[model samples]
Target: MAYVDGFVIPVKVGDRQAFIDHARQMDAIMIEEGALRIVECWADDVPEGKQTDFHRSVDRQEGETVCFSWIEWPDKATRDAAFARMGQNEVMMKTPMPFDGKRMIFGGFEPIVLLEKANG
Candidate 1:
């Protein structure tokens, strides 16, 4: 089964390009470190909810946009090992995040099922 690490971050609207640039660098590093793939999604149609929502979960403020991202790994063991390695990498440790780290939400997931459409 594939292991995944997902993230939701609130980034200033004006910093969108900067965030993308940052992600590109980070993605390259993760790929080099054994991540199968890196995906980054900018919220396009995220809706506000009365109870709880992506915006509320991240305590999003005006002039900010929500970003959804994930890293896919071959397995849990691989993911764990890569994370440990990343912690020790100087570039990974020193790179500045474009968004507020305190407000970001992230977790590792064990996928129960994954389906993909066949390509013709």
Candidate 2:
């Protein structure tokens, strides 16, 4: 089973490239620290909801876009240990985030079900 850390963030439209560059730097650190894989996705068809939605969830502003990302680890223990080691990691501490950290939403999840097709 994999332990996953998920994030939804609000980034300024003008900072898309900056965010990708930043993710590349930070994601490498996570991989070195033990993350099995990481994925960063930009919004394409997110629709506004009458009551609530991804945009509202992160308080996304008029010129911002929502990004969904995740880090996968072999297990919770590995994830926890890796994060612990990254506390005060020099590169992580120095890399600047292109989004508003205050509006980011993140959580750790234990998958309840997963299905995958075998690759040819």
Candidate 3:
């Protein structure tokens, strides 16, 4: 089964382009490291939902939405290897990223059940 790396982050209102620039720079690095696909990315506006809602669990506010992204790999081992490589990259090593890294959350996500993959 393919492995997926998921990321979720809150961006202050009106900073979408800055994040995109960062992603563009990181895309090549991620691909070389083992990402088969740099999947979906989203910059959204808040909708009606509970403060503790699963999607918004880590977010708390009315104005702040999320920047979400996913990277696909062949399997977990490949993903792990990519991460290890990323750890050594100078770009990744630099702390206090140009973009806000704290509000930016990321992880290697294992799909428990992909009920319906098709979406229009």
The best candidate in terms of lDDT: 2
The global C-alpha lDDT for each of the candidates, from Candidate 1 onward, is 0.93, 0.94, 0.69
lDDT of 1 by residue, 1-120 (tens): 489999999999999999999999989988888899899999999999999999999999999999999999999899899899999988889999999989999999999989999999
lDDT of 2 by residue, 29-110 (tens): 9999899999999999999999999999999999999999999899999999988989869888777789999999999999
- Model 2 clash pairs are none
Worst 10 contiguous positions by lDDT, candidate 3: 52-61
Model 1 is weakest, by summed lDDT over 10 consecutive residues, at 25-34
- Give per-residue CA lDDT, model 3, range 1-120, as digits (tens): 478888777665465676667777788788888788885465555464654542464453455556677898889999888888898989867733434565566887787766667888
> Can you give the TM-score per candidate against the true fold?
0.96, 0.96, 0.74
User: Model 1: residues >4 Å from true position, as ranges?
Assistant: none
- Whichever of 1 and 3 has more lDDT, that candidate is 1
Which residue window of length 10 is worst by lDDT in model 2?
87-96
Best-to-worst order by lDDT is 2, 1, 3
**Model 1: residue 72 alpha-carbon error in angstroms:** 0.7
Candidate 1 lDDT for residue 12? 96
